[model samples]
Target: MSIKTQKIFEAEFLLEDMREIIRKTSPHSAFSKDDKIQFNEKLKKLSEIVEELRTNKYTELKIKYITNGIELRTREEDFINIHPIQAAGRLTLEARKALISYGDGYSTCDWCRKPFRLDKIHRPPIDEFHSELAEFVGMDQARVVPGARRGFQAVVSSLIEKGDSVLLSAISHYTEFLAVEDSGGTVKEIPLNEKNIVTADATVQKIEDVKKNTKKLPKLIMLDHFDYMFGNEHDVYGIAKVANEYDIPFLYNGAYTVGIMPVDGKKIGADFVVGSGHKSMASVAPSGVLATTDEWASKVFRTTQMVGDITGRKFGIKEVEMLGCTLMGGTLISMMASFPKVVERTKHWDDEVKKSNQFLDEFLAVEGSKVISEYPRKHTLTKVNTTESFDKIAKTHKRRGFFLSDELRKRGIVGEFAGSTRTWKLNTYGRTWDQIKYLGHAFIDIAEKYDVPVKANKQGQYSGDV
Candidate 1:
């Protein structure tokens, strides 16, 4: 489509997408009769433009981008985006609708009330959503934060003081270390086990070593439920038990687990459970949930008591850690709009894991290819080594490392880390079974083309071959 056609196309597509939604929306929802009239009028105008573009032949038209050029990102629409962090975060149709309505900074604050808190606004039932979020993760309280990193900052700032020590997995996200540093604390890493996964026993030993050297119990223990690099599930339950045994506060980093799967903070004996809304909750970027038990919520969400020196003014109800309120815009609204579907999808996590293994079983059939992460994968994000297979071709191909990317792109696949054929990561989180098989076949077909011999699946898990 020409720029002229595409602009009108997108506009019409959006209003039509929201037409059914506005009809089905609750009576108290924000849409009004005037809003409906505006929608219809806009759609009619766009339809006329579309008819004009069609009559004139859209491709022959030259449309100018009057300002900074911006256009639709057709990656998800045009190709299989297997990027690790993105698969689970792709927005729902409902979220897209919400974004159309609440894209501005002040749009979400229209209903701000007496408490003047992000979680207290009820016009769109934001207050109810906050309560639901707490129960979703088996926590007593929850708050929306910018991202999982901010959630970590809140917990670290609350419990960790200057010179305090915290223990975390060796493979934990860098934000964890940054959070600890922000609070003037030191971080101690718990070593990975033989299989490259964090274990409860290792956590205990790390705590013991921290105590031996620092001469005190660590102030906090935080670990990832599933690490980003390997996407392998760590022993969070056992690690949380270890924290309990030592009477230390535990923070479960669910950047990879929450939203995609069911998680119980209390069941894991965790004091805090943090999740990335954009990374896993199908929301916009810079959105996340920070949840905690009542026992720890008071301190973590403590209000500011500092009085303004000049006028003796104080904001007693404003939470100090969250900087009073967070995510007061489309970011929060989109997350709420996607909440219902996110909840339903968590129940199908087993099927998701099954699909991951199904794809990997066939993918590994290409001789010399290797699964770098844990075998029979437990998560969609995977680290793979094709050094012995595709890298061999990269050595002599004209495009070198880019040849593999070129071939994958030809097959309608994208989002593999570009220019790296030796070892790289990909995600299959939300891909359909047919798409997964297509991916597997794409790999095998590419292998055959490059003389990278494809063999039968020894496990018979995926019998189809390219």
Candidate 2:
């Protein structure tokens, strides 16, 4: 197809939509007794304005903006700022600062993390580095907005236009698939290798085969830095290099590995990257980050709304001196503040978790279960896939992760189920080896209760996505 499509994907979270649904179906939170007077007053004012906006008969009201000795009148009574760019430039700085300071640059779990406050009265050090961090995960560098609605949609739409040939994993994140489909990209899944890893070679070979057989070079290369379902690590940097060699732009998503994995965009040499703030960064919910090369950053800036107002803007020295105020920004500030600590603590914990995984791997091997990816190079969120004959395998630890997750919560352990899918990704950080050991044993007990086969030695059979 010679059709050049706009490949943008936008993901939006439906909080306001949910709120409206709740309002119509369950209006309990609509207005309390305290808000009754204010609500009525607002409603009365709205009615009066609506009445004033409507004139008798078909008469029209004109609103005119006078500029350069010319009166531009609008019969439809719509108003727009003549200097939107100027207003945007002025507002962007303050908004950015507020966004940065709201979370006080840190994130702790609801149970174990701490909340930091940046007061409007005191200024923080200006030179602190808050980098956009990620690993070789797959995602395009679109803008990240507050929720799944406006921001994600914009990103998805930009990349996946109708009839474009795209490749993805069958067991990938469903939201990503939806985004691609919405953008009209035709998805083709590359089957898992025998070892189940999405090796760079495997992906490249698939592209070559597709080209040779179907006479088409893939327009876009898509894959995650870390496979979400199988706990497999694709060599993202390797793939990017290959794609670069082949003249294809790589869209990398660093969802599972962003915060936890140490990835450098420049070192990796990828074209576009997107990540989640809540995943690894201690950012608050509804925050995310997208990074690209300076050249692409300009292109994305053109397609995106370049709002200067973020939680990271600063005021004039006179304003700062008079108000004596600073801080007061977005949750990203907390993520920024807490990121180094979180990364440090998580790294230390990750080493321990790897040690634990080895122990479990050996124990399961004795029980006739297979452990995939022996001596895994990085940390992972586990996924267990067995033959169709082993349908009962899911039930073995189906509730174990949840039970352990709740138990950890009790013990102030704060790992999240990365997304709402069946994949229960555990955070190795924020807990001790003793906890993981206990949880491992608990999983064994659950497996036994389900009558799953286990060997007496349980040596090497620990196959899972981590």
Candidate 3:
């Protein structure tokens, strides 16, 4: 068959179109001759990479590890893997194809030719998509951001000032601390209860403590729906209510909740809601959505009316925090393509939770293993302490902690942090019942092989050995 008849012909056409657009839009006077030549060389390299992807030239680089999709690496598996991080945002086949098709240039912006305004008349669908996204999270307005951290940054920069105090969970993600610090605000952590869960009472106490210590009410209260370290669910509803009582603006960090579970920002009493597209929205990396209620929309999404000081050029656009246009190209397109599936999957979040609990039960059945997260997990990400069971083997084993990793790998298991025999986390978010059962059995079998006593929990029956 001729080259035109090949599957890559469409990719070739798209690349050529992109090249033509770049050439036509290029302001030759803005760049020196050498700079233009270098730019052209980079474009050529990009074109070659696209061609290689179109022809499936990278198949040889595939890894065979069965991690259940925990880490952010692609695999050639036919079925879904039982990974915590990978399960929620795992790209659909359709999303992958969409990424390739729209990967050539800033396709969305290039086609729409609009900046700052998400709801432009020329880009009706983009505007509609923004509306749908806002509605999805039960917020009044929303904008695509580079990531969830950027969402936090935008809100903090707009609302916080130097020496302003912000409230966060004791187990809040590092990004939250960085966002507040970058905005010149001080962070006060709400201590966790013995259950490893952040309670509303603790939040209230922390808020009052901050007021007393700093002699000022906290400017913002940010809490995660589900913490990353332990995957434990926090009492965001209660915390939000507390924020309202104090008249403090609340920002809901839904990095682990938004796309994977049902979240209503207004119902939760949040002024702002942040979601990670790459973490839970089934999109590529560095993509996220920042949403806000109407009460805070004017401040967070304020438009720019600045004029160039030197040339007196008026640039009417959106806020500088958003940096004008946000996500474009493959990231936005893939998110759009995966929206329907994500919507449907979130409706069945109960099933995912049930599976997670079941897997945890079997893992706990092995004597000396205990789950560190709250019992009857509300989220799929879990922290466990297996020092009694697994670490016991690591004490004298020749390979030490690595032996467990080697054994798990032999059983077609991956995603667990290597050399971690004592305390570690795993996500059983999207595993099939069979896979979950097998995973549970794999741990028990490995323990038994190591001569660790295995006593299955049987109703009221007590094993004094354990």
Candidate 4:
């Protein structure tokens, strides 16, 4: 039975931390022997598409309705509740009245401009459907999390108290310092700058060096509208104008900048924010999203239903808040019906993430290397080198980014690599521009045959040059 549940989820399993870092970085024995015979013919075409979806040979081919979000859900349904949080707040008010009647009707009914079926849309009006997702992120309310880290531990247990004082950013996002030390609160951190950018004048000089050597004014702050280990992008309205000149609170994390930047989290004076809906709205995976103000959403919904009524819902809280409310009801009805064509397919992967950061900053400014910041964020930045060449550019861009995430999972294409940097994540959602110029010419021919500085003829300094 599935090899006895893969040997009981691979024995002594702590979810095989990235398969034990791909088995102690033997990383499938660093490819080459003709890239290990094209990665064993791409693992036998992903085991012939998982043995043709286990012999049904594609039971009417529903690769989650041809991938890229909203295939309604199904791993054998049943989170029965005429209650998946009240049928996901009545399917987020029937997908906000089919996104305001598919943006004010005017349809010559080709199935009313196709795409509606989450069982034919309807229930909208839960007080104006999560107030149009809390006024589309300038929040005055929002708290939906099928997981934005329990909407960041429901705004750190409704704005800290049991020994408060939380600031952030000494290389942050370690799950917002484990949700402010599992909510008894304390954190502190601050430091960053030699291009690992975290400024608003270094978070107002660490809130003026913690109010001139600490007695606590840091009631809570947090950061990350980019800067997941070097794809830096911050300013967050100049650190919410220095947390409104020290009235404190802040909290941004916009989980990789909510759908890749242009967050308003109330014109950036964030009292709270956090997003992900599976990293910018395709949802699935423990979704995530949070927001604030309606007096911090009735004080984080009474500290998130008093930690969901004394955590009866499980061991260590978050029992799939109904699979994060059915992947936040198919990630907010596939992000309000294809968020303006997912921002017009993110301008064809913003010229392949500015030509893979000017082909890794002209291949590390011709081995003189440096460029962490002179401006780098069209979507995730940071190009390494500070002697150890950060462990040989994180073991040669993690074996060419896990052999381009196993050749984009043999053409079904999915990407991820930003954790052990030589950093690789340039998702140009539902790609093109020759699959981002053949995954940026196979990551600049494996960072120029492992000499790894990376560049060859300035991929003409990005501007419509894919």
Which candidate has the top score in TM-score? 1
Model 3 lDDT per residue over 1-466, tens place: 1232232443444466556555665765455676567657656755765766677563122233325865423332433344557667778777887886688667776546545464452442677788899999999999999889999999999999999999988888899999999989999999999878888899889888988888999999999999988898889899999999999999999999989899999999999999999989989888899999888888888878788899998757766778777887788888888998889989999999999998888788778999888888898998899999999889999999999888887776777878989998888876787787778778777877889876665563222211
* Candidate 2 lowest-lDDT run of ten: 2-11
* Candidate 3 local lDDT, residue 263: 92
- lDDT of candidates 1 onward, in order: 0.89, 0.47, 0.81, 0.53
Q: Ten-residue segment with the worst summed lDDT in candidate 4?
A: 79-88
TM-score of 1: 0.89
Superposed by TM-score, candidate 4 places the C-alpha of residue 92 at a distance from the truth, in angstroms, of: 18
Candidate 2 positional error at 446, Å: 6.1
- Candidate 4 C-alpha lDDT tens digits along 166-261: 888887867777877887888887777776667788787777777777766888888887765655666778887788788887888876656544
Q: Give the lDDT of residue 240 in candidate 1.
A: 91
Clashes of each: 0, 89, 2, 9
Q: Write the per-residue lDDT of candidate 1 for residues 109-180, one digit (tens) a residue.
A: 898888898888998899999999999999999999999999999999999999999998889999999999
Model 2 over residues 1-466: C-alpha lDDT tens digits?
0001100000011222333444554547565564555545555644543444453222233323334766542211221111111111112233334453343333222222112222211134222232223222332233333322222334556555677666665556676677668878766766666766666787778788778866887666666776655556777777778788888767667665555656566667667666665554545455555656655655443322223476644432212111221222454355455555545643463574475475455335324344344235354354432222123443454553354344333433233342222323333332245545554554455456556565544454433322
Comparing 2 and 3 on TM-score, the stronger one: 3
Runs off by more than 4 Å, candidate 1: 1-45, 48-67, 458-466
Best by lDDT: 1
In model 2, the Cα lDDT at residue 249 comes to 68
Every model's TM-score: 0.89, 0.53, 0.81, 0.30
